[model samples]
Target: MNNILNIVKHIEKSIIFILIVFLVAILVVSVVDFGLYFSRLLFYSSLEGWYEPEFLMPLFSSFLIVLIGIELLETIKAYLKDDSIHVELVILVAIIALARKIIVLDYSTMKPEKLYGLAGLILSLSVAYFLIKSAGISMKLRKKSSVDQK
Candidate 1:
């Protein structure tokens, strides 16, 4: 048991180190990509009949910034060992991912059953709300138990 515990600790330390390194790499890559994309947008803006990138480029880059923010938050949550993450974040991520899919896919070609799947996703979010409240109750009970034990 002690050996297993030691091994697990070592693995966790290694993983945290790797995560830090990878996060730095991601930040560097994101900066480089943004610079490249912004340069291209500037170059392409002068062409005739080219889509107006003034609005599009900023919107795209802003979305990329939001994505990086989300990733950074996730990394921090992991590093802090916050085992009880906010349930709303999970629901929000699910809703965003599904909404993106529903927006991008050709709705006309989608099957009737796929509509039901979207409804299911909504139902799952509702369930997640219940869990969020239940988790609060759980914490309260845990506190009570610990106080009683003391």
Candidate 2:
């Protein structure tokens, strides 16, 4: 019985260690990719004179920014633990969600009342922006020094 208990404890520790290592590796890779995607956006803009893009630049770029931003915030959250992970993400996701809504807005399907609701959503998202700034719950939270974690 004692032998079995000792083996279980060892297994638990090993499993936890493996999970942490996996998470750290994932965070490192995601951060690297985030940097790469940002650079790609810049490089594309600089090479605009050399080639005309087939896609809508603003649309794709905005979408890319949203994706990159979320990944960045998530990666930070994983490496640097915080309670505001979802809060920080929701702020940007709210903006991105609204942008996509505006981009694909179906005027015919939306009634007058629904338009008011959509507009309200947009207003709320704007308010969220101010709240995020005022709340001091962004990169500040995500990148708080690991030393301060204790």
Candidate 3:
């Protein structure tokens, strides 16, 4: 039984290592693409170029995607190190993804129901993140106080 468990654990780590390699490749490509796009955009007439929603929205979305990728990489690294998932990091990644969606969304064409759903999701994730953060802080404080009193 212990040998089987060890094999399973080794398999899991191998898969995770592969995933990390793929993710790194993707992030590198994304960063290069973003840089090329940004440089191209810079050549367009000054403030007018920056103000174009068509150009700006995609740029913002790409930037956020790269950020999300970086955050995910951190989460994966943390998991590998600690053998546990961090809820706070995952929530932050979700929030970043949502922000990216909002950035690229065409609000004028969006249905009211869809908008409401997004709002609800955002609120729920925000509340959950807050609660987790608060709990962690309180736990740390309690530990510190107990140690001090001893």
Candidate 4:
């Protein structure tokens, strides 16, 4: 039984390692893509001799994509460190993704109701993140107090 458990544990670790490698590869590609996209935007703007307001959304979106990728990498790192995924980090990633959408969204193209829906979604995620964070803090405090009593 112990040997079987050890084998299972090894398999799990291998899978996680594989995932991390793939994620790192993806992160590297994302960084390169971000740089290329940003540089192209700047180069074109320089050639045109002036920046355009239309480019603002794309620029912000690209930046946010890189930021989201970094956050995801952090989540994987945290998981590796603790052997568990953190809910707060996941929620943060979700929030960042939503923000990215908002940044790139064409308000004129979207309906008013859709915008309201996004607003509500953001609010819900924010509340959930807060609750999860507070719960984690309370759990740590409880653990500490229990240890002290013991």
By lDDT, the best candidate is 3
Supply the TM-score for candidate 2.
0.42
For model 4, how does the per-residue alpha-carbon lDDT over 23-58 read when each residue is reduced to its tens digit?
889878877888888888777656463356576667
Mark the regions of model 2 whose C-alpha exceeds 4 Å error after superposition. Answer: 1-80, 83-86, 135-150
Across residues 1-150, which tens digit of lDDT does each residue of candidate 3 receive?
656766777797899999999999999999999998888788653656577798689789889989999999998887777666777888999999998898899999999999999999999999988998987642111112222344
Ten residues in a row with the worst lDDT in model 1?
A: 138-147
Model 1 scores a TM of 0.54
lDDT of 2 by residue, 10-33 (tens): 685576567666766765676676
TM-score of each: 0.54, 0.42, 0.86, 0.78
- List where candidate 4 sits over 4 angstroms from the true fold: 47-51, 134-150
Error of 3 at 88 (Å): 0.7
Q: Whole-model Cα lDDT per candidate?
A: 0.60, 0.60, 0.83, 0.77
Prediction RMSDs, each to the true structure:
6.3, 8.9, 6.8, 5.5
Better of 1 and 3 by lDDT: 3
Determine the C-alpha RMSD for candidate 2 after optimal superposition of all C-alphas: 8.9
What CA RMSD would candidate 3 show?
6.8
